[model samples]
Target: MATDYQSAISSTLQRIFGYDRLRPGQEAVISAVVAGRSAAAIFPTGSGKSLCYQLPALLLPHLTLVVSPLLALMQDQLSFLNSRGVAAASIDSAQSREEASAVMAGVRRGEIKVLMISVERLKNERFREFIAQVPISLMVIDEAHCISEWGHNFRPDYLKLPDYQRQFAIPQALLLTATATPQVIADMQTRFAIAADDVIMTGFYRANLNLLIEPVASDDKQHRLVEWLSPRLQEGQEQPSIVYVTQQQSAEQLATMLTHHGLNACAYHAGLPAETRDTIQHQFMAGEVACIVATIAFGMGIDKADIRNVVHFDLPKSVENYSQEIGRAGRDGRPSDCLVLANRDALNVLENFVYGDTPERDGIRRVLEEIAAVQDGSGECRWELMLTALSQHSNIRPLPLKTLLVQLELRGVIAPRFSYFAEYRFKYLRDPEALIAMFEGERQRFVQLIVETSNRARTWCSLDFDALYRRGLESGVNAERSRVVSALEYFNDKGWVVLESKRMTEVYAVTPTPLDIDALSDDLHGYFKSKEESEIARLNAMLALFESDTCLSHRLARYFGDMQAPERCGHCSVCHGHVARLPSPAPLPPLESQSFVELCDQIIERYQAAFEGQVPGVDLLTRYLCGITAPLFTRLKARQSKGFSRLEAYPYAEVRQWVSVHLTGDQ
Candidate 1:
């Protein structure tokens, strides 16, 4: 039996993937997964983490459902799978309804062995219902570190994956990540019910990556980067590099700077159109573009193996980010330069990001009140909120709002149900009579009635499913909303109409616990405070790593739970005796100055309505002035005002103090 298993693995590995052997930790992870045990694979980036699940996916029965974080990641995986003649499909919002419908049908028929989707896809009510009926053998979560609230890239949606597994009755889970600290590893193990012994963690040290840190004045940093990049962009090497920045605007400006210096460079960020981002990525991969200036959004699932340089124009938000970003280079067992242009200027902006995400206590209470008010007829609540609308209404950003909701769920206040589109619009391709004629008898009459009742516009028809459901009950016909939606989807599948959905609202089942809104609000606020402190501490830790006299590579490896890494890598900045304190830029004008105070007064009076009917408190005003945009801030065009980011260079705490002392008179 042992020989047969070995032979099967070798033959499958060679025949399907054309690989001779698994990378370190991949075989063990695959073994655990194939044995029907949950396992975590903690490998560094570009270390073949995908193979841990990809290989097992082929051997698993029924299906392997992979929850990836980015569409680019899914597309890359799908392209690889398709090239290998493996049955794989992805259903994403970018796909037309016909395309998504086809993928669903293939899943239902058990024709697609591997399915990739974003975690947000699991929130779809229809998709959830469809998946519940399918038999899933394994569930793979790429970048699984996002599941932990303590992780640097904590996403609230990822917290629901375990529940989703139970809902889908998936028997085993394979959690994968390129960067997970000891804390994040433990969190993944606990959440996924994986045994500690089953977790396979390869050490984080990559000898081929030569780490370097440069400290310079803010004004001279651009010239220094150009000097660093020009050498690499020479005719022979034309080395591909990625310049990581903190903001979209920074990406654009820096890319323009690089291009002006006569180097091939382009900016990539979420702010850019999807097609443009894709084009830039493709150009980079094809070696047409020598450098990519991007925010964190650019490199989640890119699999370029020969990237020669990874430079940080600004300090990465955390150590994990720095590790992952640098790991992108030196993947092909060749020496690659990983340089960081470190300084204190970007610290204020980074810290403000932390503070901005920490929602106010009053805002938290208001959200709770809103949730509590959404009770049903039996005093039980299945609260379904359009998150964007709720965010704007409560003056909380969507991300922090999601965190609050997740915290409430953890406290047993509510459990996530499913999300659904609030409206469905369709346009008929053929005549309504022709569509009805395709059906017969009762079905035909039902289709005719549906066409007749739909509200028609210029070229599209809208269906009010709620009204139809009520009218169906009145007429003594079983016209469930789901049934009607399925009908519309069927028409779409048949090319009878083009169906479009809009306004996805997430539903939660609220528990009938005793009323304690005040306690809950306080508890949630404390959670956010703790998270904020932890994030700031993470930033400080990264700073310490750069500022210390230790080997840069050794310090990074140790931070990611690699204790056995050598004392000196001999390739990093410290080993080469190149180190300096990162200097801060010149200070801004005092907050108490007459000009600044007058500007603040004008801002408060002019943008009062941007507060969304709430009294402009110190916290909200500080966030607004610091350019940390909240939902209401953007919805009311406050971000467009000149005063929005006027104080962005100052510390958030100082701004808040000034606001309290002068505007609110709280001090």
Candidate 2:
């Protein structure tokens, strides 16, 4: 007679996923998990990383618990699995009260073979309670690099997952990430306490992706982008594309511009209402939107595999971010273009972004002072700056110090972002019959709308609250929307239902509210003074990239430690002889304080008069004064004066920096 184990595994793979063979390193990783060994799988984007763990979960005796980094990812993956007739479910912040209860009930009944959740969700007391009752055979962490401080995206709550793993005694655990350097891989192994032999890494090389970087003048970047895209967009031959911008407003502006140029496009960013984001995402996924211009927030949880091109409208924060963003393209084994619209100014923007966020010398000094006051100075690795910093703050002594430093780098802060998921249990104050009786006329129609929205999903009522409110208002409901919102909150507070919300806390550097030059310590004072001077040099270095005659791809790759071959990639603007080398303009002399102050007052007065008592914020004023074409100002034709363009002669960022220093007394 055939063994039940072999039969079950085969049936699970064929019946559920209809797959005949596992991808490259999947089978070995699955076998290791089956043998109850903890493993880490570092596969490239588009590699079948999910199958490595998902297949093993089917063979395991206990429920497989997957800790995903994003709720959207969990929902999408769960939906896909369920559609394939697999027993999978996810509990996240989006889940409705009844839906969460039903999922919990399923877990209790052993009906859910695989349960997906976000790391933030694992921190909840109730979720912890639920986990305690379930026998988890395998614990899988998606985007496991977040656990490593050295990883591009460092999530603080990810540090807490090991405790959960230990508490659950998860027989086997798996860590998965699309992008991890060799250092990051080791960091994951050390953090998870996984054996060296169990760590599996598929190489990061993706031959289908043609990484091309185009260098242009910052002022001409938009024109260059339009020229480059005009042909392909007009032809409409390629698969859907995504344009990633550094800012939310840039995404919106670019999307609008692209649409005006006759391309189907939409903007996606976190600042938009969740319903709007969901609608845009769905439309993009359904091919209703041909291109989505978005910030980093847009693509984290997206799994659409046919993205033909990924364009960077602005440079990413780091080389790792650049790699990961580009990885999103060519997922379908098709030739895909990964383009970066680089310029000297873009690099300055990235550098300034880094310097602006990173703790200054005084802030660092304060943290050191705190450490010295509290902890004993053993002085094991005084030369190791990052390790010493981590040792002073976090309690995890054996954790990878470099990883922590990387986290600090990604966060650009002394302390990582504080994050936790909140669980709210709801209790209905009235019986179902009484609740129904409470509604009449417009209220009845509003109640009906809520019921109709709730019917969208069997287990989760992922209703768009804003859309529901709008519908209620359109139905002539005189009732205040706040009452409905309060009722929902009351239900959650009363334990009639549970709602989970992920809260992320950001900590600013501990320093004087306004930086006082006069009060600075001698050494600390010198550092800031030097930093101001050094920024000009840094700006020059950025400009150098634009003027460099080398292949743009090779130059970027070299910056990220990739050794260059002799020949240049013939596809870039540099190689194509389209790049025009220009001499650096003479730097402006530092403005006298009295003159600068007078100029600021004049600009402010002009802005107030122009807008008729409605002056824009400091950022907008700075942009306007510096001759930057802000989308809103451009659309309104507000910056048409000669004075505006003349201001470009000065370093706009430096001017802004000075204005901030003088006004807020903070740098």
Candidate 3:
């Protein structure tokens, strides 16, 4: 069996991918997948993780559904697959209605073997219904570590993958990640119901990387960076490099600084328009730009192999992040430099970001109160509220709000029903009478009535689902709402019409019981508090690794569950006796000083409407002042105010304590 599998995979590898053989860990993963068993491939970046699924996808009997985190990654993978003559397509927001419709038609016709989408796409009821009709042989979850809340970059939507798998009845699962600790591996195995023995991890040690952790004062980092890069700045002497910063402004400022110092550098961050970011990425990959200053968003889908330098202009969010970011370097078996200019200045801001995501107890309570009100039949179910409006009303950001809803679902408080668009709009490609004439019997009548009932515009027509549901029941055939949707989808598939769905509204049903709203609120708040503490612990652990006396490479390897790594790499800063602890930045201004207090007062007065006719809460105020955006702060555009982020350098706890004292008139 093994011989047969290898023979087939090898031929496919050479013929399609042009690779001589599978990478070290790829064969084991591909073998397991082809044998109809679930497995995980924990290979580092550029270790050919994509091939594990890409190869087997061709061999599978049914469609392979790939869930990726970013559209750029999907595009990259699709391009590679198409270049290799594979049947692949991606359904993302970037595609036009005609394009998406064409892709769906291709999938239905068995012309597309693999489909890539964001995890959020699973929430679309129409898409889910469409997919349920297709047979999915396997589901591949890229960045599988995001499924665990304990992971460094936990995405709430990722938590739904296991359920989605069960919902879709996918026969096999493939979990892939570049960085996963033992704990994260355990979490993934348990969540996906894969046997521990099926997990294959290529260890995290990269011998070709020269890891350097340099502790420098915040004020001197710019000059130090220039000095470090000076040798590589000679004409045509620079290699492709990535300098990572924590914030968008830092990426912009540092890129400007480097360009002034004579390096062709560009900044990439989520704040830039998508087209601009794509252009910058293309330039960087083409060697037109020698260096790119970016936040964490830049490296996910990058496949460049000769990147010689990976510098941390700011401390990474966690050790896991550091490992993953540095893994992008030296992918072609060449020596590359990985540097971290460690300092304490950004610690407050990083910590503040963690604190900001945990909703305030009052906010949680208010949300629970809203739920309770809905339970009493006086208002709409909290789920029925469009997420943006709910966020603005409850003062919870969308991501954290989603987490809270997930928590509620886990506790049996509510369950999400199929979400639906409030209205379906379409533009006709064929005349209504002509299209209706193509059908016969009750179907022809249904199509004719659909056209007659639509609210028409010059070039478009709209159908309200509620009204459609009623008319469907009253039609001569007594058609169901599902039938109406099916007709529209069928028309779309046939290219008779171009359909667009808008105003998606999610539905949920609350489970009735003798409920205690206060207790539930406390429990949910505790969950967020626990998450906040866990995040802070991760940051502290990264700091400890930076300040450790052990070899940087070995320590990193061990942190990611590579126990066999040697005790010393003999090339790191610590190995050379150059270790230094990060220096703390100067203290922030006193919160109780007259001027500071007055500034706080002015801010409170200016944004009092966000407080909802009550005194500003300490947690909310501290979050606002520290540049952490809450729903209310965002809705009020507090980021535009000078007072926002005024005390961002101060510790969140300290700021909260001071705000507590002052707001209560105890200062």
Of candidates 3 and 1, the better by TM-score: 1
Clashing pairs in 1: none
lDDT of 3 by residue, 1-667 (tens): 8788778888898999998977788999999999899999998789989999999999889999999998879999999999999999999987765688899999999989999999988877779888988999999999999999989788887988888899889988999998998889999999998987789988888889988999999889999999998776566887889999998999999999999998788999999998999899999888888899999999998989999999998999999999999999999989999999998988998998899789888888877776676675544344575777777787888889999988787787777777766668899999998998998988887887788778889999988656655776787565566777778877987889998887667777776554587888888899999999989999998999999888988998888898877799887889888786998998656666635465466557756765666667788778877888887876567787767888888889988887777778555
For residues 236-270, write the lDDT of model 1, one tens digit per residue: 67898999998899999999998999888899999
Q: Positional deviation of 284 in candidate 2, in angstroms?
A: 2.6
Scanning candidate 1 in windows of ten residues, the lowest lDDT window is 594-603
Q: Itemize residue pairs with steric clashes in candidate 3.
A: none
* lDDT of candidate 3 at residue 119, scale 0 to 100: 91
Model 3: worst 10 consecutive residues (lDDT sum): 376-385
Supply the TM-score for candidate 2. Answer: 0.64
Q: What value of lDDT does candidate 3 attain over all alpha carbons?
A: 0.86
TM-score for each model: 0.92, 0.64, 0.88
Candidate 2 on 1-667: residue-level lDDT in tens?
Answer: 2245446656777877898767777766776787678998877676878887787777778899999977778877788778877799988776665688899899889899899988867645567877888988999999998886555676766866776788887777899887666667777888788998888875555656666666556677778777767665654464588888988989889888888888777899889999999999999888888788899897776778889888887866655677678788878888888877764454444544323322334434443354334323332112122333343343222132333333333333232222322222223344534555666876666656655544333334444556666776787753344455555554565554444343322222222222232343344435434544544453454445445677655664544333533347665557777563543334556654325454555556655776587644555545555655433444345565434544455555676776676666686
RMSD of each: 2.8, 12.4, 4.0
Superposed Cα RMSD, model 3: 4.0
